[model samples]
Target: MSNIQAMIVNVRVDNLEASLPLYKELAGDVEVMRFPYEDMNLALVGPFLLISGPHEKHISQHATILVESLPLVVDALAKAGAEIVDEPSEVPNGTRLVARHPDGAVFEYLQPRA
Candidate 1:
C-alpha cells in the first residue's frame, strides 16, 4: 500500500488573510489551519496550502505531500534518483524534507506529528 496521505498545492500570496476568504468560500467554509514557519505564515485551506511571506525564505516546492513516514519517503526518493534539497527536519507542522525529482519537479514531503 502506498504511504502517501494527502497532496496539497502551494499557493504563494502577498497577504494570507486577504487571500483566505476566497479559498474558504470555495472550500465551503472549511476550517483553516494557520501557523508560522520561519518568516512565513502558512495556512491550509482545504486542498490549498496558502503561503504568505518573503519569497527568498520559501522553499519553492511545487506541492506538499503528507506521508506516513519521512524515512520511507527519503529512502524511496533516494532510490528514484531524487535529489534531497533539504534534509529531513522538524517543522511547525511536522517532519519534512524538500526533494527535487529526476524530472526536476520539487516537492515537500511531510509526516505530520501524531
Candidate 2:
C-alpha cells in the first residue's frame, strides 16, 4: 500500500495581501514558505497551504497528499472511481497529479523526486 508522507490543506483566496496576514497569525511562529508558480503565490503555513492569485477561474480550495508512489496511488484512486483531472506533471519540487473523487471532492497528489 502506498503511504501518505505528508498532507496539505489548500486554501484559495482572491486577495493575497488581505489573506496572508490572517494565515500568518493563525500559524503563529511557523515560517511560511512563499512559492511563486504560474502566476500564483502559494504560502505554505505549516499544514495549511494557501494559494492566491489573479486568476478567478482557479480560485478554489483543495487538498494535496504527498504519496510514496504516484502511479500506485493514482491506480488506487482510479479504482475508487476518482477521475484524473490533470495528468502527472513535473512541478518545481516534484510530479503532481490532480483528481476528483466520485463525491465531487478534488485533490492533488504529489510524488517528490528524490
lDDT of each: 0.91, 0.82
- Which sections of candidate 2 miss by over 4 Å? 59-61
Displacement of the residue 105 alpha carbon in candidate 2, Å:
1.0
Which ranges of candidate 1 are over 4 A from the true structure?
A: none
* Clash count per candidate: 0, 0
- What's the lDDT for residue 7 in model 1? 96
Instruction: Kindly list the per-residue Cα lDDT of model 2 for residues 3-105, writing each as its tens digit.
Output: 7998998887777778878888887989878888787888888888888776675524378898888988888887998888888999987999888888888
lDDT value, residue 39 of candidate 1: 82
Tens digits of per-residue lDDT, candidate 1, 1-114, equal 889999999999999989999999987868899998888889999999898989885568899999998989988998999999999899977999999999999999999999
lDDT, model 2: 0.82
The weakest ten consecutive residues by lDDT in model 1 span 52-61
TM-scores, all models, native as reference: 0.94, 0.83
